[model samples]
Target: MAWYHTYFKGLPQRAWKLNQDEEYTDYEVDFLRDVLEITPDSKVLDVLAGYGRHAVPLATDGTALTCIDISQEYCEELQTTAGRGQLPIEVVCADVLNYALPAGQFDAAYCFGNSFSFFPRTEMQQFISQIASALKPGAHAAIHTENLAESILPNFQARNWMPVQDDIIYLAENEYRAEGGYIEAEQTFISGSEKVTHHVRQHIYTLGELTYMFEQAGLLVVGTFSNLEADPFQLGDEQLYLVARKQ
Candidate 1:
């Protein structure tokens, strides 16, 4: 199994449950609506839509959504939620890189939750290209992730810990491979009496490098934000929210 499969498998349902909170869900939906300029009739594609965090709410509000994820468990859970709520969501369990999306099918698309850099450089390029191919001309794509600038910060820490929920604490240790231009992360999740660890490797890219890749894929960079609320991007911002339009 892939490292991500092992990692996501170990996470309990409660870990996914936290993202379903109304406050966070509302903010995510609003971000998509305002930033991506989505409407109730828009057809949206959500890449790596774990547990339907954004899918369910958007579908509930009458937007059409197609979600793809590698985890069958997450897909099943999302399907159940959508069924119960009678939301218009189609969940597909497949690796995003290998999945075949209908050409020019989506009006808008997004990949959230720091999911962008999981693949190596070449594969990441292809992944972006695939998204671009799936979008209608002039359609928008939003990517939310931790900025590479944070990894290169002078004050960067190799290890950190934070509580994601009342009972769940996440511990992360990182190593930067300057030669390879990637960062390797080992994450441990502790909840109650259970503990699980997952390893992730991500390619690090400067804003210019990312822009080049997106442009090569025919996705034109239009805006960059620090977060979902559209805060102006800065040099040292921890998170990057990039918006692009298909050419």
Candidate 2:
């Protein structure tokens, strides 16, 4: 499997089916809209648009939408969601880095819900460039992600579990290592048939580091907010939403 696919390939997608309507709060939506300045007729590219959480609602504004994800399941699900609402949208199943996105086609693009920080610095820059290449000149993009300095809930550490049908779902402890740039977790799923354990890993990017990556990709920063509410960013905002335009 490609590195990008490794992120969610082992996830219990079966459980995810239960969270279809697990909607984001209005606070989140307004923040995205303000950051992206989303507008009607904007040709939008939703990268790693898992489960259409953010894309579906944006499409309601009558924007042309294209959703891409590393998981085929998600791509299919996004398309199905669009179809159910008679929304015109395109779904692509491919790694964001390797996908041959049409140059200068999108009016804007977005990578929400911490998707931008999944890759290391080297890989992250490529992700930004991929977005730049896919967008028309001056096209805007918004990225929503955890702020390494703000999101480490160190005070909260412990294991939690709940029974789900035949499975005992457990969320293991979280570790923020490598100067808060690397995160890891242990997940155990116990079912009557078998026990499955997943060790997940992700790279976290600081705001300074992310800004450098965006600049390297020739994207100019126009806005930065702490969350989806257009709140001014602070030292520990938990979330960072950045808006930039392709140069």
lDDT string, candidate 1, 142-233, tens digits: 99877465535555679998777688887889998888888788988888889887777767888888889999999999998887668777
lDDT tens digits by residue: candidate 2, 1-247: 4334654543355544443334563456555666666677788899988777777877887877898888877788888889999886888888877788899999888887666656777878888998998899888998877635555553335466666644545456667776747767676665566666667666866677777888899998887787555677777677777889889
lDDT (Cα) of model 2: 0.73
Compared with the true structure, all predictions reach lDDT values of: 0.83, 0.73
How many clashing pairs per prediction, in order? Answer: 0, 1
User: What 10-residue stretch in candidate 1 is worst by lDDT?
Assistant: 11-20
**Could you tell me how far off, in angstroms, the CA of residue 89 lies in candidate 2 after the best superposition?**
0.7
Candidate 1, lDDT over the whole model: 0.83
